[model samples]
Target: MSIYRTIGIIGAMAEELELLHRHAQMESETVKAGLVFYRGTLHGMNIIAVKSGVGKVNAAVCTQALIDLGAECILFTGVAGAVDSSLTIGDIVVSTACVQHDMDVTALGFAPGAIPYQEISVFPADEELRSLAVRASRDAVNGRVLEGVVLSGDQFIASRDKVQSLRDVFQGACAEMEGAAVAQVAHMNGIPYVVIRSMSDQADGSAHMNFAEFTVLAAGQSYAVIEGMVRSLQQA
Candidate 1:
């Protein structure tokens, strides 16, 4: 008896999504936008899950597709590079809002991270959903659970300089390729959305190595949080 009728979930990679797929009672599969969307039931709530691949356009396409398929809410989950200095690998970040860190319009004085012409550039997460996610995350993860902005870009953050830039510009807890785009779509569609990221790397010189070693662990943390959220919603 969740308040939301159906939840759409988008994961950024195979490892990010593989475990959850096994848990959901998949009823049907649809292939669209080069992504396989699994329609199913999880924790007594209707869910449509998909691996959104990577990057902004792919994530945006995945979100809209889920909406078209009747998802009332969107949940985007995956691992990301930590941008905040306080964050460590394995920390979980539940986005209060999302921003495209790469969306620069500085020349036109639109300010960094602003999507020109849009009423709001930094898309917001649903307040109710955000609270639910935060509560669930604390219960689900052994690591630190944080509430902050999620920064998205088409690039894999590896440089320390770039990480500092993002930290100064957006104050994001995590930086990834897809979450903000998903947020943008959900915002435009007037659908409630939440983006969850578990830190796999520090977005520094050793990021790639760290990401390779910790992505699965980080993804597991994120999945647990998602499960916790679904259970909370169902019981509510």
Candidate 2:
């Protein structure tokens, strides 16, 4: 019997999943049963990919489902709005940690971005995977590859003020819809995971106007780096 290595991918938008799936062959039975699952190869490693809708709750649910089916590592791959001006569109961000910037408990005296009601300071990315992601980012970046924290929440950030607030409180470089939640779920289940995202826009007034034109291309660039990382893992 072949030793199976299961890797889960959570694509935030429909285009992300569609672009990823396009990289796989459409053979019947390749997809795993009873889950919105698909199977394919990356650097000769078997992969199971799934779309995790959008938002924290949806991402959590999909992550648990992947864990239940024996995914050893889950990757949240998609696009994010850059909080750091140094990062431009198409720059890949491989997070060292993630924060739910929207999580607030000020009355309880916990600082925003604190793991609510817990002593843990922040959620860490799997170091081994992070290393590989860095390598992959280096290979794929058109502009630059930045490693930092990515803030997660339901809303798509399209304001300079909100983006500035996130940067101020979390020191996050990018903002996405699902990464932190996926990391939290993976942590709970003892599964290792990481987030790899490409900057789609600066989270400013221009973001909303530019989103439609850039989202797919940004997601494709993200998928390319993620694919490289998965391939590297297979080789090792």
Candidate 3:
């Protein structure tokens, strides 16, 4: 038996979700709100996996739908661009916290990245889940595994200046298009959630080329980590 009755797993790309789907047993799928949710069991745990389209709005929508369907917790797995230069392709980053790098409202006197009513920027991941992710990454990933803040924005970071700017502001390990938005939605709903990512690029001018060449390898690394996490939960 698993600790949670039902877990929600979300990814922005088809490749990410496909890997999970292939591993699922007794799976059934339903489409709603332009997203497809796959309900099944993985490693003895009940799961709902969805391929959320790219970007923040898409991620939030999928998360809310998962919540409406009675998901107790959410897990996001995908590839990210490395914000810290020390990170390399296939290295895993398990998010300890998440922030929307594009959420700037300084003109309204709110600090950059702060939500108007919340008056806060960074949102912490669920400690228990983050810890489990770290352990799983250590067990499964071949490259370095790190736990740090992850920044999300609509833009795909592909320039040195943009990457440096985000790192300077958020001090994050990785940058992606959707993680922070999913984190915010989960936070508001009082659901525990964690974000796990594999670095596919350095978030520099060569990012696009690097991503195209290494995304498959990075995704495989992330999938292994996620599998290890599910196994850990099943045993726990």
Candidate 4:
């Protein structure tokens, strides 16, 4: 209803959304609500940021809804557990591509990690947006920016052994519950999108033990990176 241009942002949890919303409010125009959309003007650009709840289905549904509401680009921002040894809590992972780690189709004659009914095993991110995210993460914090594949699954991977297995198999940088699904939705709709996640915990050894303690700092760093990306996108 207002100006028409829109960028969709999907936050996987309430805390994540709260951070994004707080940043949005600091912009000049307050967000306006529609039947299924929350519209705001940030740096003179229209944005619709929504909490996609959790899991793959929820993320996909919310993404589709945003696209239907006229979003041209979708950005999935939130926290993830680190899969790579080089990463640490609070580091940013800017995805080069995403895959569903939980997907298994070998029994049905499809390869493991491939989406059912889909030919491609990997879904790539929008290059331009990925570049912007990398720069933003570097600018936002002294945190290192890891540009690698992201693996998404239904499980919350806090197990070191399990995380190591996944890392060995997929060589993924981070593990989250929603990135691949969000990417799939965007790909299907022919819309541009990118997944940006901050490391909330190490996927190995003490991941489970330290998750509670690391979440606050992880989410805060994640918010700053995403906020910087939003601002960068506006400049672009």
What's the residue-level lDDT of 235 in candidate 2?
70
C-alpha lDDT of all candidate models, in order: 0.89, 0.80, 0.87, 0.80
Please give the lDDT score at residue 49 for candidate 4: 76
In terms of lDDT, model 2 sits at 0.80
In model 1, the runs with Cα more than 4 Å from the true position are none
Write down the lDDT that model 4 would get.
0.80
Regions more than 4 Å wrong, model 3: none
Q: Against the correct fold, how does model 4 do in TM-score?
A: 0.89
Per-residue lDDT tens digits of candidate 4, residues 1-236?
A: 22226777778876776776676753332222322356776666678877887899888888888887778988888889899989988888999999999998779887669877766769899998899788888887677889999999999887878888897889999999999999988898888888988888887667778877777776676677667766776666
Error of 1 at 124 (Å): 0.8
RMSD of each: 1.0, 2.6, 1.2, 3.7
In candidate 4, stretches whose alpha carbon ends up further than 4 angstroms from where it belongs are 1-4, 25-36
lDDT of 3 by residue, 143-164 (tens): 8988999999999899999988
Decreasing TM-score order of the candidates: 1, 3, 2, 4
lDDT of 3: 0.87
Global CA lDDT computed for model 1: 0.89
Q: Give the TM-score of candidate 2.
A: 0.91
Error of 1 at 12 (Å): 0.7
